[model samples]
Target: MAKKQKEKNNEVILALKAIVEEKGISEELLFDTLEDALVAAYRKNYASSGTENVRVDMNKETGEIKVFSLRQVVSEVNDKDQEISLEEAKAIDEKYELLDMVQKEVTPENFARVAAQSAKQIVTQRIREAERNIVYDEFHEKEFDIVIGHMQRKDKGNLYIDLGKTETILPPSEQIMGEEYEFNEKIVLYVVEVKQNPKGPMILVSRTHPGLVKRLFEKEVPEIYDGIVEINAISREAGSRTKIAVSSNDPEVEPMGACVGPRGIRVQNIVNELGNEKIDIIKWSEDPAELIENALSPAKVINVIIDEDTKSSKVIVDDNQLSLAIGKEGQNVRLAAKLTGWKIDIKNEEQYEKELQDALEKEAKEDPNVEKAIDSDLENLEKLEDEADIEGVIEDVDALKDAKLEEETLKEEEVLESQNIERDIELVPKDDDEYKFKETDETETEIVADEDYEYKVPEEEKED
Candidate 1:
């Protein structure tokens, strides 16, 4: 019997070792839980009032369990389960006093089925609780970070991402709109929160978080990871677009270009991960006006008028660029406001001019002197215009005089050419055979030369 009992203890020790190894639970914790379960089992099976003081001891080395019932020695026992007579207690120990408590071994022949079931339940509950604590500690350290997980399932529009050791919940508010989740699909998520619960660690993750973009950039862009570039701000409309502001601490580095990478390879990888969502990488500036200008990108801005007191800005764009600045449903301006922490009112050049004119007109009506001031300003402007007109007329007259001199010089040269041609004709020999002549009695050469001279002078005068 002794050998068999030893073998049973050895088997129990081996089983405990297996459980500790498989469950990743501390051996000491398991032992304490087992001792408590045994105590409860003993009270339920053996104690009459179910309130008897029972103690359970387990050997950590051997996994051997012992149960003891504690009873007080009295002159006369009133409760048989709780007290022992002095005479009876003296049989076990001679030094027993009237109020001395004695302990008796009460290992049962067999544990009742109900007690066994209760013990199993207690053990299982304790194990589950230990597991929950372990999981909570593991995930609590990972809060506000990025995690990779696989899509496990969806329930009531909430997605469960299986993150290796535990699962994380993606709430509807954190999920990208119109995004389809597939089973077993690998996805990246940003851990927003971690909570400890009875079941396990409750990890709240997000797909639409701004941190997700920052983390993705850090992962894709080496400059961000190395701290050469820092993300200053981010504004996102999930599944549509995201704007990120980054600045470089190193003077030699261009923050926007670093985030964009060579030929946009860095940002493109992040875009693909986000289901082709558009990303705008803007250079961060310390000046609010320059920051707002960069925040509302892909739209050319004419100027930015900032109100320092109100922390607001009026952005002016060309009339045709208004829609681009405002974006579809005002997404561009909305994101710029978020990124810059300023109230941005976007207006076209025409609208701004009209608004300015209206404000001036209203101001003029409010003050009687404003009208007189405006009249004086108009008079000064007209005088300046008149002076400009006189200057322009003087310049035009000088230009015309220069042109007339050039024309006179051209006419004198033409007259000299005509005289030369007449001399050449006179130099031609009359006897030359090239000049065919009929012998007329009247002197026709002088008449012909004189008629030519008269015809040329009238034609030149007509041209002049």
Candidate 2:
């Protein structure tokens, strides 16, 4: 019986090693899982309350399993099963201290038989969880990148792609319009998002993303991968057309020629992969006006008037190229606007002239007085000049009248000052003899003067 038991333990160890090799699971993880399963089985079968703090220790070389019940050291013992007094704990081991966990063997005689039945189910569940974690970690690094996948099946407009180790989801919104998806068809996709689910990792991929075109260019063009060429921007109308702006870091290399490859083979490969969608490769410019001009390709741009404040541009083309610049239903200009990050308005020479004339007429209608001032003839200007001259002559005449009245007032004031008369006057002769005069009524005054002396009247006051 002892020899048979030894053989059984060896068989268990060999089986664990085989599982590690077959499932790609770490041996350490498997041992930890098995020990946990043993602990649970011991609690269920041997422990009285099934709530004891139990742990399992396994010998990695011999597959020997043992179960122990843990008891924490405390100042006072409360529960005998889980807590031990410090004195009792110190007796078992001199190094034991407070809060120290002391473990005692609790493995039952029939634990191996009971644990084997329970470990099968628990280990299988743990292995599944480990596999999911491994896959999630592997694909999470691939987010925002591109991957090649094969179409496996379609369900409710969603495509399931087989990516070797896992599957990814491709929804209808990310799919190209009018493009047929066949069984086992190989295609390139841009990984949009990676989500962790309970069952597995969910990878979301796209076919219509501009990033798909960018990654394809990077893969095809050696100049781009070497950092000699850089993609500035990309705008795509999937299944129809795409516009990509590229710039060169080195002055010796042309970005357009590098991406086009020799004999157009490089771009043609990408075009074929995208179901023959048209691609326009444009040179990037730092100037907004120049960039806007390049963004609208296949139709020549005469001028690009940029409004930096509004981030908009008005593109003027030849009259014959107007329809082509605007494209069918304005698709060309729309894609150009998105690529350049600007609002674009396209017009020909005649349309632009008409727009300018209409703007002037509108301004004239809004303010009629300004229009009248601008439209005034030479006759109207001459009438205004004559009215200004008449006003100046009237001002001169008024000034002369005011001067004549002032002169008359000055003469009157001079006469009054010369009279020096009062209501009662005392006249003194040259010999110092005094004579008195009094006024009785208006215009009647008695005058007293020296008879011997002659009385003289001034010529200026004679009238007064």
Best by lDDT: 2
Off by over 4 Å in 2: 49-51, 368-464
Query: Model 1: per-residue lDDT, tens digit, 1-464?
Result: 66676677678778878988988889999889888998888887677778787888878776566788899999988888889999999999999999999998877764433455768889888988888887788777878889899999999998888988787878899988888878999988988889987678788899999989988998999999999999999999988999999999999999989988899999999999898999988989999989999999999877777889999988877677899999999999999999999999998755765676676688788986776655644553354334333444568976776666466556645775788533211222343212111213452222122111221232454565
Q: How far is candidate 2 from the true structure (C-alpha RMSD, Å)?
A: 27.1
For every model shown, what is its TM-score relative to the native structure? 0.68, 0.74
Compared with the true structure, all predictions reach lDDT values of 0.79, 0.80
RMSD of each: 14.6, 27.1
Model 1 lDDT, residue 15, Cα: 82
Candidate 2, run of 10 with poorest lDDT: 376-385
Candidate 1: give the clashing pairs: none
What is the Cα-based lDDT of residue 453 in candidate 2? 35
